[model samples]
Target: MSAIRSATVSDLEPLSQLLDDYRRFYAQPSDPAAARAFLAQRLGAADSRLLVHAGQAGALSGFVQLYPVLSTVSLAPRWLLNDLYVHPEARGRGIGRALMQAAATLAREHGVPRLTLSTQTHNKAAQALYESLGWQRNDAFHGYTLTLD
Candidate 1:
């Protein structure tokens, strides 16, 4: 086990692979090149933040990416935990839990009001982890997305 730390351009390759696997988990098509490019763009921009958990052998075990968004009602910055993934081989090693905790810690350190994320309703394991970590379900409002494409 290793500590979770902020990601950098140097971590691009492993990060992209992990991200690609994550997208695949959501039924996205395989596209490693696209994943690499996408992660590069995000890492280049200051718009998003990422934390990675590396294994004892220096392999990437899991990662969490956060995008900052404004909360108009609260008039404060909030973090959207847009992506979180632990490699299948790395599951149950506490990597997912560590990534989530690291993401929340980052938000708190930045003085952000909250950290938000959405996982498929079928993802009971992730939901359990979130609840165990003190993240409450947003029952007050419904979330909707309209794809332009």
Candidate 2:
């Protein structure tokens, strides 16, 4: 299994490529420049935590991006695992699992009470991976999103 570590600014170029691929997987248009800019802003602002797995030749094979969230009811910090992606060629090599484990470790290190993530209902592969890692499906609450654009 490849070692998972925190992403640095030096990883921007390859990380952006991975981010673009991730967006494309979700049916988004390919826009490398936009992906780079978005990741740049996140890294610069220190608003999100990015964990990456390096593949052969030091290329990033997978990544997980977590955003901090405050739970009012719990009065504690939590993480919203907004993005997790493994290169198609790198799948099944345990990179995704490593990334998720690393994310959980990081969250625990920061005293976060919990970590949360959502995947499309049709993404059975991802759902299985997450469940295997002990992530439970939230049956108690429904998630609703308001898109204003």
lDDT of every predicted structure (CA atoms): 0.91, 0.94
lDDT of 1 by residue, 67-117 (tens): 999999999999999999999988998889989988888888899979989
| Poorest stretch of ten by lDDT in candidate 1 | 1-10
Return the lDDT, model 2, position 29: 100
Worst 10 residues of 2 by lDDT: 1-10
Candidate 2 at residue 116, lDDT? 95
Give me the runs in candidate 1 sitting further than 4 Å from their true place: none
Clashes of each: 0, 0
Give every collision pair in model 2: none
* Models, CA RMSD each: 0.9, 1.1
Model 1: pairs clashing at backbone N, Cα or C within 3 Å: none
